[model samples]
Target: MTVTESAQKPEAPANEEQPVVYKSNLEDFEREADVRLPFLLSYREVKLLGIAGVGFFLDAYDLFIINPVATMLQYRLYGGNELPANLEGFVKAGANIGSVIGQFAFGYSADYFGRKAVYGKELMLIIFATIGSICDPTGAISPSGSLIWLGVWRIILGIGIGGDYPMSASVATDRANLRRRGTLLSYIFANQGWGSFVGSLATIIVLLCYKHTMEVDGHTSKVDGVWRILVGLSLIPAFGTLYQRLTLPESTRYAEAQKAAQRVQDEESIEQLKKKANADPGVSEKTKHSSDEEGSGTQTPTVETATAESQSVKAAKELAHAKKGHFKEFFAYFSEWRHLKVLLGTCVCWFLLDIAFYGVNLNQNVVLQQMGFDGSEGTPWNRLFKIGIGNLIITALGFVPGYYATILTIEKLGRKWIQIQGFLMAALFLGILAGKFYTLNTPSFIVCFAFLQFFFNFGANTTTYCYPAEVFPTRFRASAHGMSAACGKAGAIISALAFNSLTKSIGTPAVLWIFVGCCIFGAAFTLLLPEVRDRDPDVVYEQELRERERARH
Candidate 1:
């Protein structure tokens, strides 16, 4: 019924400078953190998911909502004219640009400081950015100025979106029991599908509520309410999650890593004190003999002084290391070929996956047109309604189902297998879609697009997310994941900026072929990763380091 998480120091303290809890038996704490909590579906596990999961839900919502919002904006600002191509690219890619910054900054911060220290700060950034985005003063600004305004706010919004990648991944992996680590990570990420689906659903529902208005006034200014309301809806969840995120407990594994570090420093201080204490053997022996003869024994002043000096030396070293600790640790860990290659693999694969994934996604309206579901030949309300309805069907048919497929099969099939197959299958579909681009009828194109989405969710898209968080040791986990995620976002920025222009120049079929190539390369890069199921990276890293030291000796 209840799984008592053998408590490590409670993560939320009343104040920032509260005393550190020192546990001397670091191994026992390690076992407690890495081994026990995963034994069952406890309330603590649920609470952790709720707190971490909400931000990811927001991640997808904030990022993808822009698509529909952009469509609605055409009506609101341009009176149903096509959105300016340059502005459209900027508006869509802005969040991703900010995300790259957030991913790198927050990823390093999470690992370098502590998850506890920085957990909610990114969410705080997100809330502010979201507000800034929805509150764009369209009336005060020209259409072009308004687009620039939304673009700027979304860049800020992207930072929060980007930060969540590493923050949530590291938090989930550090605490997950090896048995269900993949499952836990998948479930947290699966919130994205819901975010995507719900964004469209809300657009539809809210637009319907204004059915009479849009119908009465074609290309009406009232469309402004639809986009703004959709953007604003995400705020409710953000506000609801703020108190919990700010106060949620730090990952137990992270806490254990900290304690282990303290223990090593303490041990070194003791060792240094002993070396200094015996420096003058004659004086120390004489003092010891005199104390024994007096029926009592005590440390000589020299010994006490040596101990104080050693403690002070440790303190000073700690302070200096604190200045550049995480920076040093990050570079040192990834410096070796063995470690560096793995990081590269995750980065390369994620980078490739995003290029294709976001390319298709950012231009979904184009795809919908290819499938005859674009609602282009309709009244004003009818056009918006058709777009909304098409999004709902497409998202429902592909996005959520694909994610669920991975969740169900990930443990048995393994992350590497799923990822490789997912990439290959997606490439295959993209190839078919490219070949049949003009030839295919509506039903055929829908089938290809749906299956492409399916494999993407089931393969590299979800697994790209899981791999980095699980494969790196605690010391570099956040930074590495952030780096990988940043690379992926960089790819997204590429596609977001280029997809429209690329399709215009080369045609959508050629663009589909390019995505096919990206997917094929994605599968190739996926080959670089080892199977991470049922293993802990920290233990593997320590073991490898020890073996290397022995070999060097």
Candidate 2:
């Protein structure tokens, strides 16, 4: 009998408790609630998010480390050789291009497979690449050839950093509960601040300690070990978190999806059996015939009990199947998938925001010099140390506190509003800095620089990373984030490669204007996204789907 018929059939006595029969279609019921995973998660959730957060730390370290290292390379690696402006651009752009590739490749692959399969593998790839690049020798190489090697390995490193974006973002999204998801995700992302701060600190320590003994640019120097030490430092976080990630559970949503898919298959088989029994009387009659050869005959206790037992198993399996869909199963999320628009929009915003954010950040060194921070004029060691300290100070004053503040308040404020306001703030500051760069002296310039960095973190940087993982459905959440993050990395590449040349040719003020423009565009684009704070991930899709259905009708 169908569920409707079963539900309508009868009721038991008041004193006797009855089984709660779920008479709804499996699809309809499954849509309503996914079962919690078999294992306990509250404690494990914290551990898993921590593992992912560490990935962001390494990612931040590797990315910002380039700034200090670039200065060191300009003096040390190229042999105080004047690096042609064009070659300098290529060297910088290499890693960002690689990041774009890694993000897209790993991200799509993770979505196609399981999140657990892709999680820690990227970090290992980074470790090996870092080791290989460090081992590169300059003995037989021309300046161009050496740069090619540097760019190649940087690309390799970029891939690993790129992969971290989706893996970490999606993991946090998958593990967090609805009530505090934004808060948790922001915490995971805030590791970038520490990464930036530490990168600067590492550069400072290496430069200061090595300052007196070395020779470069016709002077005594302190930056001989700078390249090797800075690059090697990234390995610490990679090794520290690898083992912990291996032990973490695949997300409960993933587990539930897998279980749900299995149940559906089982229910279909049972339904098929019932159909065959009805179709061929000879096959079914062997058991049911005992109840009635004629209409007048009644079901015996033995026969009724057997039929009831079989029906009970079938119902239980259906219930189980409806509750947890398969994690690996690819539900056609765009066509048959109801929440495709939101996913598409979220991904696009990440791409747009990244192009602007990275373009500005990647070329910040040029801005530093334009603002009169030319380390080339001072004692080489003293110059590098000053620049490194500046990086550390800006990171501490701007990124660290802004990120922690976001983590504390995201739940109360909401993700959409925060992102919208963040983009606007970043745009506003960039505009101010662009207009003032020519007019401001050192003190005012420093203040504006600090303000721009602060507002960028306090506003857009925190939200762009947080929103993607929050918006997508569990099945494709990582993949979607990967795509968006990859788009952002593409922006990073544009910034890295072109920022120097753009500044050299067009001037620093124009470059700042470009960033300001990107920020403005980002702010305008963000207005389209739905507000998602304090909302459940599972139900968000359903709510979006319903809105579409209502529109259609």
RMSD of each: 6.8, 9.4
Q: TM per model? A: 0.85, 0.77
User: Which lDDT tens digits does candidate 2 get at residues 1-553?
Assistant: 1011111112433643232122212333233323532122344445655688887888778778876776676675565556766666666776677778888888776665566777788888889888976765654677577667777888888888888888877766765555556776777888888888888888877776675565344443235366777889888888988876655555655544444345446655666766788898886785366435544334546556656787658645643554344333335455543356566566666766766667766666655665565565666676777777667767877778878767766777777777777777777777877887778787777777777777677777888888778776665677778777876776666666667667789987788788777777777767766777755554554444445446644
Residue-level lDDT of model 1, residues 507-553, one tens digit each, is: 98898899999998888877778999987776686566546546644
What overall lDDT, based on C-alpha atoms, would model 2 receive against the true structure?
A: 0.67
- Please list the C-alpha lDDT of all candidates, in the order they appear: 0.81, 0.67
Q: Which stretches of candidate 1 lie over 4 Å from their true place?
A: 1-41, 217-219, 261-324, 548-553
Q: Tally clashes: model 2.
A: 12
Error of 1 at 447 (Å): 1.6
lDDT of 1: 0.81
Colliding residue pairs in candidate 1 = none
Model 1 lowest lDDT segment of ten: 1-10
Best by lDDT: 1
